[model samples]
Target: MHRTLLWLLATAALAGSAGPPARTAMPAPPPAVGEAARTGGRPWPVPGTPVVVRTWNPPATPYGPGHRGVDLAAPPGTEIRAVAAGRVTFAGPVAGTGVLTITLDGSGSPPLRTTYEPVRALVRVGERVAAGQLVATVETEEAAPAHCKEEGCLHWGLKRGEVYLNPLALVRGGHARLLPVWGV
Candidate 1:
């Protein structure tokens, strides 16, 4: 008796159904906060709009192979500027190449550090630098090995402790946002 009643209910439910449920459109979420939003508008380290020879390519694992920074095409002796106000944490050579690092002010815990390599240091460690201030000049080929084979390039990097971030985000105010496909 219970089996017969169950069968009747199942038959009635299926008979009332037309087909599978239709999918409804949902609103796209807002863009995530980026470095530019957190640090305000930071300027590009290189003068003018330098051509990007290489973009940031993060590693899959901590020890994985990846380009930790972006490479901007600049000629030898091109002036380099500070992207944000901060103190110079390191200004010296690393493996025969001149390197300069600045710890950004008010960038939160651990703070954000910006680094430029193959640059002759103009600011010393512990020196407070303001945004857009000249910090260093790109090293000549004779001073250091060429980073880019075709032309001299400045390797710019940004990190919060051990995590590497896209440096371009600092200049652009954030990453590019994609629009919804349905025009929402």
Candidate 2:
């Protein structure tokens, strides 16, 4: 019965076509480069924040699937920052994702890597940036703008070479323990 119900839901979603039932409308996007973005931002998303965290690695099915990234919920225009120092490997609108992917040369667990564009990439594939630097902004689409299995939340995946690492481990490693940000 459960399997049948799941199949039915999947069928309905596909039938909608206008793109996954049109997720709740997020507020119109704020200017892409807000103060933080302009200044390589910091703790941007906070509690009460509306979006949902997508993936934290693997980017597949977390359990029986491969989890490739970490996800955070937010509206478009939310300032995104580089966790550590690195070079921008690729940035631009790939497919439909307004996305940005930064490959930290040396920092934050095997090159502090960060991606901000699942909807539209901002930086190029090889732009050098500093830690806390603003790489790009979020998209303000009613549904997941791009690069997502489902357009609902920000999917973040941390990786080193071919290994998909858990994002929380990095933040909670060694001595520091930054609590997960719920929403603002």
Candidate 3:
């Protein structure tokens, strides 16, 4: 009886010590090449500028093991523009990193919410901004860790209700579909 009791206590102690699961948010799968066309929207958040996708994993659930957004290879202090007309809803720090959210207007039921992270907000909350209008600037390593090696990156995300939608769909005019290079 004593041995069984000890085993139970050891198991309980180990389980309690385990704590919460570590967050392993993987990058979302590549978006469809060209799904449905965007109803209507502006250009890339950073226009006329070349950008590389650093990370593109969107979490599979509202709180799941997936990247909830895409990280673009952007230099620190790069200007971030609004993808569409909307009013700034949130501009604040999240876990020591700055985050800015804009609730898009006329985006349909629930309204799509766009988020830019590791940014320094240039626009104020509740301020109306037009497509292509500057809203924030990517922060430098001095402010936060350079997420993209020494270059830094901008984490952009889009969500409707609690569902995380690919923000690339907005930039590419639709979903970025995967096309086979050679037919088998």
lDDT against the true structure, each candidate: 0.71, 0.48, 0.66
- Which stretches of model 2 miss by more than 4 angstroms? 1-64, 107-112, 142-152, 175-184
Give the number of the best model, judged by lDDT: 1
Task: Candidate 1: list runs displaced more than 4 Å.
Answer: 1-40, 142-147, 174-184
Q: Which model scores highest in TM-score?
A: 1
Superior by lDDT: candidate 1 or candidate 2: 1
The whole-model C-alpha lDDT of candidate 2 against the native structure comes to 0.48
Q: Which regions of candidate 3 deviate over 4 angstroms?
A: 1-41, 142-147, 174-184
lDDT-wise, the better of 1 and 3 is: 1
Backbone clashes, each candidate: 0, 48, 12
Tens digit of per-residue lDDT, candidate 1, span 5-102: 44334433332322332222212211222332355555678766567676677677999987777788777888988888999999999988899999
Query: Poorest 10 consecutive residues of model 2 by lDDT?
Result: 14-23
**Candidate 2 positional error at 6, Å:** 42
lDDT of 3 by residue, 85-180 (tens): 899999999888899999998776677899998899999899998877889999876554445647777788888788676676565433223346
List the pairs of residues colliding in candidate 1. none
After superposition on all C-alphas, the RMSD of every candidate to the true structure, in Å, is 18.3, 13.6, 15.2
Rank order (by lDDT, best first): 1, 3, 2
